[model samples]
Target: MKQIFTFLILGLGVCSGVQAQVDAVQKLDAVILSDSKLKNYAAGIKIEKLTDSVLSNNATSLTNLLAFNSNIYFKENGAGMVSSPSFRGTTASQTAVIWNGININSQLNGQTDFNTVNTSNYSSIDIRSGGGSVQYGSGSIGGSIHLNNDLKFSNHAETRIKTGYGSFNSKNLGINSSFGSEAWTANIGVDYVDSDNDYKYLGTDSVNENGEFHNLNMNVNLGVFISDKDILKLYHQSYIGERNFSGTLVGPSRSKYEDENFRSMLEWSRIIGKFSSRLKVVHLHEMFKYFENKDKDNYSLGKVNTLLINHSFNVSFNEKLQFKTILEYSNSKGNGDSFKEPVRNVFSTTALLNHKPNNSISYGVNLRQDFTTGGERPFVFSVDAGFDLFEHYQIQINGSKNYRIPTFNDLYWQPGGNLDLVPESSYQIDLGQNFNYPNFNVKLNGYYINTEDMIQWQPNSTGLWSPINIGEVASYGAEVEVKSHYNINEHQFNVSGHYSYTVSEDLETNKQLIYVPFHKGNLALAYNYKAVTVFYQHMFNGDVFTTADNLEGRFTSLNGYDVGNIGCNYTFFKNTKNELETGITLKNIFNEVYENVAFRPMPNRNFNIQINYKF
Candidate 1:
């Protein structure tokens, strides 16, 4: 795999030198934006929007686009190493990752490494599921993932490029650009990935030793209008990663890891007459390094920094009332070789209300409060409702209260830190149903959760390990979704799918909960026949136990699998400016002998090839 055919022949010689600067610009077709504060206060919460052709067909990572399109489970330790996520059955520090409206997790380990993100640097990707910490603060209890940036003004300009080559010697590159005027606007994204993941081990013959990895990502967005009621915004993101720590079919290793992240934000908005205002400022940075012996240069370091401020106000009061208010502040600092006191501060306030007295019905209410320097200060709330029972039916309901605090190595780890830990609470509820026709759509949901003081790190009586407030947990779930679209004349069709059923428990040893997966599902299909397209995807997972007492022999458990993938694409140089596309894919197909983590072996039957250019 020596540099994978010289980076696929230097990415086809830089796509033939940008195809001679492809002019006559006008090819921007990718849109699906929302997050006007969760579409105006999140009435019955169940968001799941991921488009832009499913983020350019999962342009690799956000854990391969939410484990092949969302019912989230992922535990990965190989094949790009370390990825985590479990949402709905919670834990990965209770899932939350939002950007472009703050809360970027990890103040020294609250979580968020979905393989260092990079889903082609985002331009909208949302997934909201149960409880959201009264609008994203501390680990939004089992749900929350949004990353957005969309701006538009008037005239336009564009550029796009992508390249890929795959299977064990993987490679990728991407670039995007945008421009607009009338006031101003901008967007940019960049991505790069590499892998030499080694692969092999299905029934064992070794290989996959020091699994390699690489990453880089960048994103930026800007906007300005500043006059007929002022507006301004800016955002930036960056990430860098490195990896090598895979070796477990009976060991032979040399650990290594490195990480870096940065984020910045600024915003302002205004309008007066019935009030509408917003202001935000944010900054975040994280760092990490570790090396047990990658030729021994010795390593161990950690760092964290955060600063934030936010303000919001909105009002309507008529045509069916509305209101919003928020204020927030934060400061965090951490340093490490296993901390021993590193600063924290927080303050928060929020309130929201919405009502609709027409078109069947709607409702929302949310509240939050927190103030901390030391531990628990929480008070949160949420209530949601919606209904419209005919002409395609709908109904929804929600409830919430969520919290999580204590990180910085669980409050200053030094031989086992834990100076009185508290703050882990949860309570949740959700129920929903929806149906629509004309081209079909359906959704259904059910949920429940209860948790309290549930933190654990065990080992006492002189065996060090700290962090307490143990035991008590429960989770329940159900979800189903389906979607469809069709056309007959030039032929186009699409379909989508999802399913999940979970049960996470520990209520005093009632078992289950280590890697928790009680079934999961996915499916996708597409067909278009004018410029050619074809696609397919499938996934399923079940049976995961690995010891929290639900164990069963041989390495404890992990046995359930189904995987598939297929692809096609074509669209040669077309009109109205420029375009070129080509594609190929075939992953796992039927060569599946899986492991989500037991001994970590996955990947067989693989392929990929892609190229795209636009202007």
Candidate 2:
């Protein structure tokens, strides 16, 4: 270990010689896609943007991308395995995942597995924290995450290749290329990763075996400039993977899983008079296979297919007022070993009005209605306003009504299915304040949410669990974020931190909700000198309860823990149009023994190093 550290240091030091001869590399140009329709109508909303740097990091999956914000928490069984995220104090099903302007939640469970999402597939990511059902459809009571690929029309061609080696015999490789002509552009990307995640745990002296995974992803994008006012774009992506499940210390089970997913979309936009219109068609297919070596009866297989057609138009009425309307239609079908075959069709319409009467004030209102083939109809609305009090101070507020429909599993699972279940609905509000300075920025936001007709599974007189809609919850939270930057000659420094406090309680029993943390915080510092950059990050998670009763302190309790990480990057070679870069990251510097999910132990200290070349 000591020799490896010495070699890494020597390698970085040898590359420093080029700092004196090379000029600073220019930043990549930001690509603008037509998918910014939702962002343009939002006021007093908190949105976090994750660039390529945050997406393509040492972390194994998308879980790490959401963890960068203290307000969102991801519960993972372990590295390279199943993971889910909770926003504010809402459940995983309440958080929506939007891929290229379309909701991609599973029809079976109404949830998206973070482990199956590869960050290398997308060029940009955006997270909106609050209810967004007014613009999006159901299953957005908590928040929404958007992954988009930008279609860049450039004059030059570029290619990049990246590879990484890490602990537990982990390996990753990716290739991306783009070429453009006068009126046509094309881009393609491919990524592959495999890992033998047999890391040791605290309770067991021997390393946990049967923890392996393999993944592959490919994407293609094509864009055509139909004149100067009209554009057409097409995208396609596919993912295939297999994983072995690693059970907890108390009970170990031998099982393996396989998954295949494919998605495609076509979009066309045109500018007519003062109105801009866009039309999109999307298709998604997913399949999963589960095998239990010891018990074949417990094995299962399932698949789902979905198609969507959507259209929207934005009209700029002068510069102070704008109106946008959207119409969407969706069809979904699910089939499985135990699930009853079900097909659902849904249609929705939305209208938004925005007004910016003055330079310091802006406001927006939204109204939407959804109709489903099952005869379930829902109506939602939102209102938001923003005020710039002074040059350095600003205030904003927003309120919305949201809803989440029952999943196929909740309504069609053999013995536990309940066809009489109703949709869950929520009312939420948010208030925020911001202070900006030349070198620093500070933001604080507080929110409250109340939900009714919540669904849960409970055992009946027959001693079998069945879905029921007899639950209610009240959730509230506050978040704070601060950022600062400094520069001295050739050296640059950046500091940022965030803290959150949340409370969720059941209205019936007045008991604290399970799995929701009351406190979370993060702090990070970064320094850049010439061609080298270094960063240190720290995180703290409050204790969580596995059961609503909070049983024994050692049994049902998941104690809080603190973790630290340090990393560095170096640009070894650079020219006008080409560059070579390498970096290393060390996680859990102190080797803390902790678990995000009860009974599931996380790995100890780990290290990963990556290299990239672009030309």
Candidate 3:
């Protein structure tokens, strides 16, 4: 399609999959919540063998809590929808979100936005910020979000059902059921959602453009306990969507787009006294089709398939000694009628050590290497440590040497894009402190990243933009978060907020990076009574943006606020064998109009209600 050999001259080797997650198995470094490290802990964030379903009615959005005072430098585009989730001045794609343990992102291609992912399917989501390579894997120069899910459990039956409708014609319906027995456990669930999102803009005759989003998700997990020391599982998940992206509520009828993805995993684990081993194989397929306009008459579509397999081991000799190792392999085939025949393989390995020398201190470090058949073969490494000082005080320090290989899209995004790009490499460091007191908690963190071979859509003297790696970048930022949870008789309340600020600049030209906010964050206060809760959400933004230089001073930013949400739940029936639950959600309660992202207009206040019964 486009000259595909440009980056080949620099990166060519038998690349591998991600290395293993090596952590101390010794009692000293062993961290457990509830029971069963792989089962319960996984439900919280670990990702391998989790517990509950996150999409249940009792669950909330991933950003629900973090949005309050957490984003510093978030930019809102003209049309309104929070353009995408950017962190510390980075674009959406810069922040990698992993579903399960594998990365679903299209390399540096930057296709799917963070918002495209509904945290609804996960049992819990873990966020690792600031070049956290050791904890995650590669492409984490910015940060990472990991989604944990529940595997099929035995001898239990549970069903979840919910329905809700709120402002701007938004509504959701979900039903999921799970069954487990001694020999096998099976789980199946489905979700349906539709939204007619429309919000008014400030100082404009045009209401923010709106997009109707329709989504469907299906997943199944089957597992068997082969023996007292061994277990095997099969996991399958799929998602489909029809999205409108014209930055308008009602555009050309044919303008909406569609996306479909499916994934399957087979895993086995064995335990013997102080040693354990695990193996997993995965297969994934994805397709994306979009229109140049709503007409749907003409569209450009693409598809990709990936097969990845991984193995790892852990051993503990005593309360202080532990060892771990991992290896993986992957093959990706990208073929689209309108694209190229991109094929490649990767290999990876990692080693780590974790120590809790005392009750007041804990730390860890790791070494990693990645090799790809037709891509860059970079050796990366990371180290981190967290200390609980004295009492109620925590301090964390982390750093990493990581690289992000350029994706095919960066060099081949069509007509005028460049295909001759170099991979980006960076070094990052972060330090943070936290204090927890009975009912109050506070956390403060500072981070910095220095990058070489930075990716850019540079404008040429002729005024056209082309992807290039001819620049360097430096990013520095700080975040402060505070939370208070207290109960007054029948009333309970949680007040939480965060303040984030980032300054990112190009080292080569001394200019600000594109589409990054200089300051952003949110504040939320929720009050609850028996079966009732009311929430007040406020989001704030500071000045910063990106656009054609021709509109130097024409850009508009948020120095504004948006009020969101109000809801209540009611229990109509309760018995040992039967129960009924109902609730409602009011979004944008005050009807205040605002946008968190550029070009995406969120609906004004809305309402939703749900009812559930058990037999």
Q: Best candidate, TM-score-wise? A: 2
Q: Cα RMSD to native, each candidate?
A: 25.5, 12.3, 6.5
Provide the global lDDT of candidate 3 against the true structure: 0.61
Residue 109 in model 3: lDDT: 64
lDDT per residue (tens digit) for residues 8-102 in model 2:
43343333233312433232222447466557887678777764555655344677666754468778887778888878888888999988888
lDDT per residue, candidate 1, 88-180, as tens digits? 898887898888667798987798888888877777788898888877877889888898777777778888899898888889888888887
TM-score, cand. 3: 0.84
TM-score of each: 0.32, 0.92, 0.84
lDDT of 3 at 377: 67
Per-residue alpha-carbon lDDT of candidate 3 for residues 1-615, written as tens digits (9 for 90 to 100): 012321221121111111122332222111111112222111111111212321332333444433443452333332212235566666565666666666676642653444445545655555556764433455667776666565644467877676666555667776777777766677777777776655454345655343667778887767777765567777788888787763533332335678788989887765566666667898988887877677647777777788998766655555554555566678887876445667767777655556656666666656666777755766776666777775888787877787776665665555444656766788988888878899998878888888888776767888877778866788888887778889989999888777778888877667666556566677767776775656666766655544423134534432345555666667677676666877776666787655554444445555667776665
Tell me the whole-model lDDT of each prediction, alpha carbons only: 0.81, 0.81, 0.61
For candidate 1, give the lDDT of residue 366: 83
Backbone clash total for model 2 is 0
Given candidate 2, what's the lDDT at residue 571?
A: 94
Candidate number achieving the greatest lDDT relative to the actual structure: 2
